[model samples]
Target: MTETFTVTVEPLEREVECRADQPILDACLRAGVWLPHACTHGTCGTCKVEVLDGDVEHNDASDFALMEFERNEGKTLTCVATPTSDVIIEADVEVEEGVVHHPVQDFAGRLVSIEDVARQTRRLVIDLDREMAFNPGQYVTIEVPGTDATRTYSMANPPSEPGRIELQIRRTPGGLATDGWIFKDLGAGETLRLSGPYGRFFLREARTAPAILIGGGTGLAPLKSIVRHVLEGGLAHRLYLYQGARMQADLYDVDFFRGLEADHPEQFTYRPCLSDEEWDGPHGLVTDVVDADFPTCRKHMAYLCGPPPMVEAALKTLMRKRLFPRDIYREDFFDASDKATGGVRSPLLKA
Candidate 1:
């Protein structure tokens, strides 16, 4: 027999049944309730909540954003906590309503092509028989055939067009999905299963401030989609794209971004930086470049997508320069292989 428990979530008075082994956040997701979360593995503190009344069993998720005092007061990270009995919890979590869009049609798609963009990064284009509508910055979970493993990748393609999606994947040594399947032996016409257009990392149309986009390595995947959408929409806000790589070889699609900047000189600027390269162009870390160029970030809206280290560094730099956390958006790309190889470390969790 499967163990089940009832969970009452306050502020919305929503109740849902959760399996004894399932995390509260996963239950909420299945129940069609949206919650603010990043790095679902007990880090980033985006899913912290207070337990008003209930008996629950959960491992310490100090890394998930809960202070010791809060944890002592019955606070828990919903993504890692499992209820032992009927429970009531209170949170200020934002729940997205309506059906979520996905890039794969009904969780199935065929890999139509894979193009090498760099030495370690490749762009995989998958074609689906049916349309998969998704916001540009949202990502999908791909399950490679013949394995129980899965990996999440942001769709480089925009939602305005459907029936196909593009993903830029970075190969990690010993990564089962990235190194084993995607990078080594995966080929065209292969079938892959996918789910979700999940993530709250998409660009917000409400802000009209001059925008700053920061991306590192393959994190440029979603940033590219946002820039394309902004350019295509012809939004009048001034936009600047700052992409950082260790060397010039890691930077891809320079001509595409250059064309965008040329077409909209008054509204767009593209700056590619090589942190450790011998180039005469912009040098040093990407956030450092942002700091030197724009000292006051108060009037700017920033969208950051990248590795945890770069994201944390950029966040600190932005906050120090007067940009509000609410005005900044980010997507933390978690390495799924860490779960398998025990090598993935989240900076947010450490904080």
Candidate 2:
């Protein structure tokens, strides 16, 4: 028999059973209690909860998410922690009134196609067994068959299409998932298991401010979804998309983005930037480009998704332009450093 413990959630006054081998957040989701979470691997710190009593063990939490002070204050990341005993936790537990909270569902999907759009980036489209509904900027965690490991990728396409989702994955040289499985062996018609519609990085409805969407490398995936969502809804907020790459060839999906701009010329603006190589268009870091264009971002809502360094630099630039922390939403998917921190960066392996 498997060891199991009860988790008591305060404020909501709910209780759920967690297996010894599974994270607490997973248990909560399995019980249909949708707690907010971004990176379920413990890098993002979005699923933090205060332990009111009992003991919890950190399985694979990163220092970035669970700091020493936070740990001392009885805080734990539910996504990476399994309870050693029956525990009581305090967390922000509320379901949006009108929004349907889609609990995590096991989905089987066959790889429809994988085409190289850039030198090291591949665009993959999968047709699922059943229709999956997700908001813009949500991601799915795919189970690597024959292993306990899983990899996450944000949706590059919107939910306008039923039973399908697109992803743009950057090649990770020797990664277990990217190189070992996805690159070396994954083939069309191969069935894969995935679960989610995870993350709180989606677009906020009923916004009147102009939106600025920034992306780097494979981070363009979620931004692509956001842009398409806005366009499809015929929302009239001025939208600016700034996609940055190290070299010219690193840029992809230019024709599609250009087509969006052409259709909504007055509302949409596309700016593709290059940092390492000299380009006739914009030639600088993405943060520098944003600094030059929007000197004052008092009335702007910024959404950024990219490597950690790029997202950090852009955050500073946005703050300098007078944008409040609440006005700027970010999803830092990768760590660009050579450190073995598990992130979306190339060769980013999770132990």
Candidate 3:
């Protein structure tokens, strides 16, 4: 039997019950205490906190993400560190308005359908046992069948369409979640244990600035959710969505987004760019297209999701175009490989 302990959080002075084997961040979130977190697997270091007292076992946190020196200095990555005793820790609690906090919970999902949506990409439609309430740009962690591993994916559908989930997955050769399961033995009608509403990269409805959305590869998933939420609710702000792919064959949901643009010309703009192979339709990176379309973004907000390189480049481009760091949101789609070679992360960035 796993022994439970009370973990005390500073500043707020909140307490949450956590099992000996559970991560502190997991306990905090489930208790409705939204501490800062990203990558949830200890690679990104966004959930780093200071252990003001008590001890913990740092469970699979990468040395690069939680430096040895930092560990010696009483800092721990709350996402991967499990409490050994009653603990007191200090974590950054970001308060952003118009963002609804949803407590994380587990759900039993049945895979209703799966099909190829693009080159090396598949679209999965899952029906959950019950409805889940999440923000427009949040994600879920899916447990890989026949293994103890799990993979995280952003939802492509909006919260309004609860009880059903649309997931866009990009196949990675020999990858655990991709090759070993999803693209391999997984099939329709299969049941999966998954959890949600993780991540903080959702749309900020309180902000009045028109938004610029940039996505690459399967990064388009969460962005799709945001698009639907805004358009369906008839938000007044304009939206410019740019999706970058390797080529025409690599892109998906063309006609769908085009239909959206046709219906909402004044409020919606869609641009799909191809980088590798092009045959006459916005040839270049998506960020390059955004750079060409907008001369400046002084009073606009931007949401970027994709590979780290693309996100980094877009950050530079947006900042160069006069968008402040606070006005931009990013969610880097990291994988197991990224967990191996941990990359640089910022406290200001929302996952």
Candidate 4:
């Protein structure tokens, strides 16, 4: 018999089962623990946890993922850590008392349409065979046949309609999944297998404060989902969306966002920032625009989605503006590295 291990999480005081061969994060996900995580391949450090007892091995985690100092401090990246014995660890708990997280499951879906939304981005619409009820900011991992690759993309549309999914995909320069299949070979009516409804980047129902939504490039997908959910629900809390791109051509879905602002001027605002090209509207990085507009965010909640560097910078700026760390949420897009290497993209794009 294969030896199984048990994992005890602190604060939440919960237990999850782990197989000898599987990662701790996978086990937690299988048990519906909803521990916060992003990259499942040890690239991103979002799944870092502190080991309190027993033993584990991080044979698959990258050196950049855990420093010698952190390891000495009994910290491990849950995504790559495999239990050698029953273990206890401290990690961020995301589950609420009455809320349930639908466990990850495989579903069949077919491509409905693909449209070029920007110079290097495409909007993909899919019709799922099963009703996959997911949070607005969740994503699904899609399998690409004829190649050992998959792409992670967040839904641009909310879960208002079942069996329907929409995604914005950015074309990587030399990506195996994007260049080979997503761009050149895949077509409508093609069947695809997907598993997920993963990610903790969704909107918090309990937050009644104003929301500041920020995104860069195709990172706007999940933010779009949240915005649609907020607007459709007729929430009175103010909403601000800041979308950044390199040039005007890189900007997509401006009309929809603009329409949203026009419809609810008192409750919503949209700002598009350009970094490379000269623009009459907001200029420089999205963080710069945010700093220029909002001097303080003491009472607002912030949701950021973008490249890691951009997300980090924006987070720092928001913190400087008086937003507490607990009030700020982020989802970093890891497409370039994951897609080029033919590895699974970070689950941030999935959920």
Candidate 5:
């Protein structure tokens, strides 16, 4: 058996046994340490931590995420680093009063159904053995059948439905999880091993400002969760959702959101933008459309999710429109392919 090493988490002063090959972030989160992380596959630098003592093996971390200079300076991506000896790591730990930090847990899920939602996207409905407590915008890592590889997808359904969740997945041309499995022979009633409530991309309820949610393609998954949460809980803040897609065929659930807008006409607004084709709503990039709609986004909270290009574009637009960086939250949906191409972000936008 491989020996386990003791990992001491700073500030919390807690110790946990980490398997020889386990990522430091995994060990910490499973131990309820809750280190801030996004895109847990090591492409995003959100899990970067300082190793105060001992050594670690940085495995498969993107050079952009954990640069050579940073590696030499004792910085490592906890999601890809494994402790080679007993060590202590100082993680960025913050506390927000209204946010609930749900402990991560594993569950066996049964695929209930999957149907084409858009041209290259599918909506997957999964039923878990037990309820999973996760904040809106959090995701789960699912172990691919017939392989040890895992893929993370955000829960599109709100937290109210704890035992069941919905996911909006866009098929990647030759992705291991997409083309290799999820879009292949995978069928209903198949058993899937998953673990979650990962990522800090959830709603920030403490702020009372109106929310501007922007999502590109399948990135709408988590934003759907936040919208449902607000509408269900009867939250007072107004919500504006902007969905960006290439064309009408790339858009899904347009009627569903229209129905929601009809129900809450005074509180919710949905804008669907199609860049490649003409549409009744908007005709340009989602960020450009939003920039035109809201001349100034003073005191408004922004939630952005999508490919790095879209997310960064929205961030720039929001900041330029006078939204504070502290009020803008974003989650970049990075795949392994992005690691090589690189999408290194400013540490100031770290969240």
Candidate 6:
């Protein structure tokens, strides 16, 4: 028997139905209602909402995402909360005008090919059944065929074109998806299930403030999308991109970024940093470069995407440089395999 529930969103007077065993966010997506969310696994606080009415069951979620006070105040992460009955929830759903348009899509995709972008990263190109409308910085969850495991990867393709989706994936040691493919090999024409166009990490057009983008490893994936959007839209504001890797070879798309700087001679700047390499472009951690360049981050809007440690460290440095916490936007990339295999702990969860 299928159970049905109702969700009433405040101020907007919008109501949606929730099906049994489905997350509230998933139900919203099915009903064409877009909500801010990242890492649908109850990590990022983007999908947080106030449960104004009814009872709901949620899986174990990170306290950092929804604190004890917030929870006591009837707040919950909509991504992992399943409605037990009729429910009413309130969230901020206003999409800023002129920003990228993102919609949920259920499209069939076939893996066309995979090319090694670097020793640790591979670029996967997927051909979808139809064009998926998504902003450059949005992400999709790829469900491993015949398994319950799914991994979220950012779309590196430009929003202007959508039929094909591109993903930059880093091979996590002992990761089921990466490890299995590494040794067994996967051929073309393998079908995989995908859903989304999720995330609010896309560029905001109204803000003409000077911008700084920081990325690490595969975190560069979404930043690449935003840069392409900015260039294509002809936004003339100054833009600085800093990408850091362990060594020279780890800087996968240095040429691609350099091309952007060359094309928009006056508008863009590119700095590639190596954390532990002999050669020099920019040395030390990526955050150190930001601190050196922008001593006083008074009017800059910063976008950071990367591993948790990098994101945390950069946040501290940005704060120290006088950057307002609200002016900084970030998407922390969590490796599912690393968490599952005990390789690394999610700092967000740790906090």
Model 3 deviation from the true structure expressed as Cα RMSD, one decimal place: 1.4
Ranking by lDDT: 5, 3, 2, 4, 6, 1
Cα lDDT for residue 243, model 1? 93
TM-score (C-alpha) between model 3 and the true structure: 0.97
The reply for model 6, stretches above 4 Å from the true place, is 63-73, 92-97, 181-184, 337-351
**lDDT score, candidate 3:** 0.90
Off by over 4 Å in 3: 344-351
Which number leads on lDDT? 5
Candidate 5: segments with Cα more than 4 A from true spot:
344-348
Q: What overall lDDT, based on C-alpha atoms, would model 6 receive against the true structure?
A: 0.80
Clashing pairs in 5: none
Q: Model 1, 308: alpha-carbon shift in Å?
A: 1.4
lDDT of 4: 0.82
lDDT, model 1: 0.79
Candidate 1 residue pairs that clash: none
TM-score of 4: 0.85
lDDT of every model, 2 decimals: 0.79, 0.83, 0.90, 0.82, 0.90, 0.80
RMSD of each: 3.9, 3.8, 1.4, 4.3, 1.3, 3.0
RMSD of 1: 3.9
The positional error of residue 115 in candidate 5, measured at the CA in angstroms, is: 0.4
Residues 53-165 of candidate 5 have per-residue lDDT tens digits of 98999998998888899999999999889999999999888878888888788999999998988898999999999999989899999998788778999999999999999
Show the colliding residue pairs in model 3: none
Each prediction's number of clashing residue pairs: 0, 0, 0, 5, 0, 0
lDDT value, residue 118 of candidate 2: 90
TM-score of each: 0.83, 0.91, 0.97, 0.85, 0.97, 0.90
The Cα RMSD in angstroms, rounded to one decimal, for candidate 4 relative to the true structure is 4.3
- Clash count for candidate 1 is 0
TM-score of 5: 0.97
